[model samples]
Target chain A: MNQPIAHASLAPATPFRTAADARRAIRSGAWTGHTVGLAPANVQGNLMILPADLAGDFLRFCQANPKPCPLLGVSEPGSRRLPALGLDLDLATDAPGYRVFEHGELTAEVPDLEAIWRDDFVTFVIGCSFSFEEALLAAGVPLRHVAEGRNVAMYTTAIPTTAAGPFHGPLVVSMRPMKAADAIRAIQITGRLPAVHGAPVHIGDPSLIGIADIAAPDFGDPVAILPDEMPVFWACGVTPQAVAMAAKPALCVTHAPGLMLITDLLNRDLAFV
Target chain B: MNQPIAHASLAPATPFRTAADARRAIRSGAWTGHTVGLAPANVQGNLMILPADLAGDFLRFCQANPKPCPLLGVSEPGSRRLPALGLDLDLATDAPGYRVFEHGELTAEVPDLEAIWRDDFVTFVIGCSFSFEEALLAAGVPLRHVAEGRNVAMYTTAIPTTAAGPFHGPLVVSMRPMKAADAIRAIQITGRLPAVHGAPVHIGDPSLIGIADIAAPDFGDPVAILPDEMPVFWACGVTPQAVAMAAKPALCVTHAPGLMLITDLLNRDLAFV
Candidate 1:
């Protein structure tokens, strides 16, 4: 999961203390790296931009599978600003990096979407697990992937997501191995934040969910599952991207994996309480 | 787990619709049976009345172990009424049945505490799992024991409770067998009711918590566990009674298992939201 050392020079000299600061840095081209540890207190969202023609069905798909695609805010067609997320935030440029998909195939990776921005584009900000991860870490529950500096292991499960139009596929889940006690605490802590993939989707035996091997994952780097720990699975934000890709949309733009759009909303604000 | 058929003759022809009605029925000589399923929409509490001298330490014990001994309301010494629980409820007679314990040994079973009420007694109303069970059932999560017409299986665990003065012992947990999906839903539903036992303390394996057999329980009748289900355990309110018994208070009083004090508070009122 180690990043290329050559890219270290583009990393920010100091970590961002707020979502606004992080977005400013990304917009100014000072930070072009993954947003994992940056703006730790604010919500970082999964970005998905599609044409207005496909927006209705995709919105229904999100409503059908809220655990994986909890819609935080949706932008009006062709609008760059999502005032609810940030007053001056530009959906096309706020994310550090963006993946351009042409007919469901990754055609290009761009630092900013200015050249490809379209008038009929609609932006959908989906809540990511990072919000609840911050909550769990704040409560002293250790996340193995975060501690080891690796991407959380994600898998494709046999569990079918509720379909809407062409958006229908198997659910994707992120795994975090923890002791039984921590797993229970994680459930309680994350259960409070329904916007961010609330609670665990499955626990204990991974085979029940159709994962053939515990050591290998379909997405992200695999981390160690200690002898005493159980792998706890949460519905992943990757589900929307995967399902959208399977449908072969003519044009779809998403934040690259590990690179998210930092929003001004605080993580605590996302908690249902 | 069946109660004597003779007791059915003493039960009300129709179940009480509210806590006030149930308490009134118990106060009168019309109801002398277990309070399960009676006043189902309200909070049912485990009653614990101890001497005034021991009240301080007992309160601390409950505060330290809120999961197992969630303190709902504490009465002023010698006070028969708890206005917060119910405006006209009498601690001495609201419960359907009570067990008189002298020096930690069960001496006699009585319908009410009027004959043995003490001037220096302090009634401690502890939250019970029945509140969360109601929430689970309302959410369409089926509870095996409730469906089978049996007691929820309970086991004494290797997990120990934090000590406060003389009160200290192993944590007792109530087990509910559920399929993976229902167990996940149950955790989220029950997690919202922290005033009750809250989310599960442990899940998946029983032996890990020192239980030798899943079929045989330390207390309450063992209900059938389906082959596809896992036993999910929650911190049982029985922990307080067990800890108090180990302390051997000179005179202690408690509601007999399954016979709880119905409180005026609605189950929805206890949700953390």
Candidate 2:
């Protein structure tokens, strides 16, 4: 298991300041760790690559469940470039790492997708919570998990996602415990960035959403919740991975958890206002 | 004491399709009740008329405490018209009723400001919760106060308003009980309308903000809270009134509670997005 990267290590001692710089470093195998705080001003996205046959249904699923799977960009069959997100973005190798799955079962983790690129592949770039986390931190709402060098605690909720074809599963949520004041501000700040899991799905209680234990999360590390803090949950981008796995597509690929596709699009561009 | 006006009576037999028509009715003394639910599509504002000598301090106060006192429009001293809010708006008589205060004590409740209009008077139109409430209702979030035909329960909070000169006091908040789901939605919906107490100041608990009892409120009527409901509070426009009274200006004027100045600006115009 990969140990959680310290928040300080998110900004590596490298000359990669722009998204293009970061992508080049990522493509050249210069950086293989999580891209949490790297390229801090630009938008980082969750990536999912599926065969052309399953792309249409996945698009519909994202449309039906936008809060979890906000589609930032979608590529045509066999395409690797997404000029809208970044002038030089190459989906096949832009992410820090890629997870290859065959029949929904993870087969290998590779630094680049060039080794097993498929002509029928279609890439979907979904908005991630990183953009809003940047917004929250900029607004002075301290994130406990990020501060403590732990992954955001994630849980499978009782709430069901709106199904589209074979893509369906219980909604997955990422949790961050915060003071009520910070939580209120977080809601307002994140609410403006709907492309990145806007606002929160649930707040205050855990069992209310079917979580049996606050200390144990279905995914990620659980951070300490102080007596004054409330556990706020946002619909996770991981939902698509869960749904895609459940669908059992012939071939599917995704960025390894916390390893995202850095884009030239500034976080401000995603803000609705 | 005047009985709470039925939501039906808010719309009279007169044709008030436009804000100008509604103002004309109020000016002609044809409408003399609460303005809630009337001219539903237009923005209704809380009215505050202060002498020129205090206008600067009041404006600073509003600037310092924006959430509780969102200043929508302010008129030149002695000007009865605010062309920005409405082409035909007359600050002197557009509202249904006015409260005259002398040294911060209410001396009279009159239908029009005509009898006491002064050359030194400066009119201020503050954004009211009614605009965001309209947005909330339009978004299908049911307001318990509206449904129960009572005023939104308001309370005084331990949160202090940033002071500008003599204007300083505890922040006033209006509470609406909603399930956690609706509360989250309300935050997103209202967060877009910052001109009118955007988003909520507090959620979940009342005592956390210094309210000793959840059953009793300092202002407005309390409504029922179901087992699933959590009380959400927004910065109330009434904060200005409380602050102004505490300051004890020589003479001040405000629209009677629930009576407001209907403006031509549509509620949609207030949405940040």
Candidate 3:
């Protein structure tokens, strides 16, 4: 799938007061595309919108499968404002892009969800990998995908998620190649942030987790796995989308992959003891 | 050296009362042997005594090398009580066994220090592995050393210790083998207890930490390392004693290998945010 499209760099004449100002610019049709490296150091969220009926099951699924679907905030039926994440936030337009799925089928990829917003829609703001990635980078952990400028490779593992009502599927995991020592440190650092898919699900041999082919993942782009490097897997935010699609919900909507809903909450504020 | 000589356990009828009662038994000719399975939940510590002149440097040494020498409580020169660790604690007689060193040379191993107590001596209580081991065992993490009835293999590694004052030497580490998943869990569990040797310093290939041979460790008996297991190494408290001996002070003292000083402080009290 094509990314939401990278946002245009600042036009050199834009005025900015806070994170909400940046979001306003993006929402005003002045900004378009992926939000990578833009307004970073803020907690970005993976978006999922579903009918109010399935909201309870999806919430349970997220609670059961915290490593993959760390819940940051959940909106009431038909609500748009996630004031906890942002003040001027409108899920329909604040995000850079959207993927509309009908009957678990990709129907369209667009810049905004305004035309498709339904009164019965309940929005879920799941934590993205950006916070942990920021932490890893701060700790000097070399991220192969970031260096190579590609999406982190993700795999559908044989590890089954705890079935919550109709929401059930194999856990999806994103892989990053790191040295063993760094992998250990990464586990400790990420463990501190349970809100962001805390700690790693698996490290070392991918075969142990039933990944038949590490070279070819089921999703995302594959990067080099060096001789001394181990493929450390984290429960990815994508797992919820995969689980939702597999269950064949009549209608579902999600953020275009990588085009997260940037929020005002600093990543550091999400730490748990 | 013959172990604490478990004569008490051979025909034991006495149920130990308090930590002080247990220490007094070990002090007076009532008991001598492994403290393990004795005071189940109490905090145990590795003991080190240095001359006042070199105590400042050793303090810096501990501050610099926190992983190996997580200093829990320190006593002033000529003072035997560490009120932070326990009530009415007398360092000279609290430990079951004491090793005396003269200018880096082993002079004697005794049950108590009453015969050699000096006015200028300063005592330090370093966090030991027993605290975390109890936690791991409580969590059902199989410990190969205790299972096989052997001492956890310890090695002097090429990983250098941060030196302060006259104490500078290679880091000494203790090895325990566990499956990859368990190793990750152990890291997370121990990482919460920094007062004890927090987390594994190095894992997987023992050679990464300069262990020439995994089968033969420099100290402690070697346990089985299963093929499915990774040898996780923790910064051992022995590193300071080894460094202290190497530094060769006029007179130094430490608790014998495994006979640690049991304190009234509970292990759970050591967990810090």
Candidate 4:
């Protein structure tokens, strides 16, 4: 989970309300710290802005591996808003932070996208694990990361993604410790929300996916694991960014890892059935 | 898909009609065969009838594992009708065949229960995997078992069911061969219908659940497997019948495997969302 900034004077009543208001505040540069726990119930997503040239591959990538890169919204080329996600969404500056890349190289960290707003930029909103995390929380599934106030332990697995042009790399997974019964029920509950990483990709043995160490993670912080619990892993949204970076695009922009775009779309809207 | 059992006497258009129509045909000995792939899209279920003394334990066993043995309808003690499944559902004579077990032993394979319908018999209609299979077929997921026109491969796993009196045994799983793409879609599609062994229990590696061989199943014939596919397993309805037979009630009876009770209820009615 992303650590959100505490703005005592501006915090909203509830987590959901706080998210909507927080995004609005971030759009205006009032609060640009982080959007992790701010709007807890609402669907928060990772952003990938690229020219129309690269979007086709990214779209294919998201469509191919929907579990990790579940697409919530895809803006028209040169458009600044994705009406499906939020009626008043401004893709360029709605997120709390942005990382600009030129030729896949890190260039600048901007609070807002006022300077590099490109007419050719197309914004793609991919579903993150946070939406399902919220769903799990609502269903009374104990989340070790949230309980311990630590980011989920994310590992780069050897399982390769379905190739979509230049977007192809090893799949990324986030680990969560859970009892067998809770794991089964969590699969049933999260299985309802296809847009939120859906059900876990792999369960039981971590070695099956090529994770050498359970205690160490490629990204995020490691939480505690009890004796009776199995570490469940879900495909992550960073997969596309990692794939895109490896692809070496001429120009790429994305939200900072922890600073996701909070959308007005209710998490419940993600359930297919 | 298995060849539809089209009776010449009945309207050829209605694949499998009312239980009365089926039983009337069966009683006259017009049609005596497997009921599966007979009723097309209608709900086909497992049938169980035990003496009144052992009804409570059997009911508890069904309740314990709703996935494998979801109780669609249960009859009053000494009654042969299940009003919930069908208005004129006569459990004593509806199914084409019945397996009679006495003292945990197979005593006879009969055409009807009229001669042996005990006054204290309690009939229970348990949900079969047929409902979800219909949904999967409707969703355009190519079923390998159905394509090969064979019974779904079922295996007994090391995973044990919650003990309810004397009825307890390892969980039984039905296998379906599917590629990653179809497997994911199958997960989402089947997850909607919880009454039909919703989703899958173990996917990818079969040995992880203690099944030494995927091809050689304990029950049901094996189907063809593709190189790009994984063997997706589901909690099979046979788990209850097998366990009940193992427990060896004083007088126990069940529908012949593959020949189930056809109910009037639509498969979609069982969907949670």
List DockQ for all candidates.
0.61, 0.66, 0.55, 0.15
DockQ leaderboard ranking: 2, 1, 3, 4
Reference-based lDDT, residue A59, model 1: 95
Structural similarity to truth (TM-score) of each candidate:
0.91, 0.90, 0.91, 0.75
* Root-mean-square deviation per candidate: 4.1, 3.5, 3.8, 6.7
* Docking quality class, candidate 4: incorrect
Segments of candidate 2 deviating more than 4 angstroms: A1-15, B1-15
Chain B TM-score, candidates in order: 0.93, 0.94, 0.92, 0.90
In the predicted model 3, the residue pairs found to clash are A5-A33, A5-A34, A6-A34
**Mind giving the per-residue lDDT tens digits that candidate 4 earns over B1-273?**
011111111111344466456656655657777766566557777888998888898899888888788888889999987787777777888788888888778778898999998889988888877778878888888887676666678888988999888889989888888765566567767767777777688776677688998878887776777766667788988788778878877788888766678887778778852
Candidate 2 chain A weakest lDDT stretch, 10 residues: A1-10
TM-score of chain B of 4: 0.90
Model 2: per-residue Cα lDDT over A1-273, one tens digit each: 111211121342345678898998888889887786778888888889998888999999999999999999999789998899988889988888888887878788888888789888999999988788878888999988777766788888999999988999999899999888898889878877889998898988788889999899888887898877889999988788888988888789888766889998899888852
Model 1, span A52-108: residue lDDT tens: 999999999999999999999999999999999999899999998998888888888
| Candidate 3 ranges beyond 4 A from true positions | A1-17, B1-14
| Pick by DockQ: 2 or 3, better one | 2
Estimate the overall C-alpha local distance difference test score of candidate 4.
Answer: 0.77
Q: How do the residues A95-138 of candidate 3 rate in per-residue lDDT, one tens digit apiece?
A: 87888888788889888888888998999999878788888988
i-RMS, each model, one decimal: 1.5, 1.2, 1.5, 4.9
| DockQ of candidate model 1 | 0.61
Tens digit of lDDT per residue, candidate 3, span B145-176? 77766777888899999878788989989888
TM-score of 2: 0.90
Q: How many backbone clashes does candidate 3 have?
A: 3
Task: Quote the lDDT for B225 in model 3.
Answer: 80
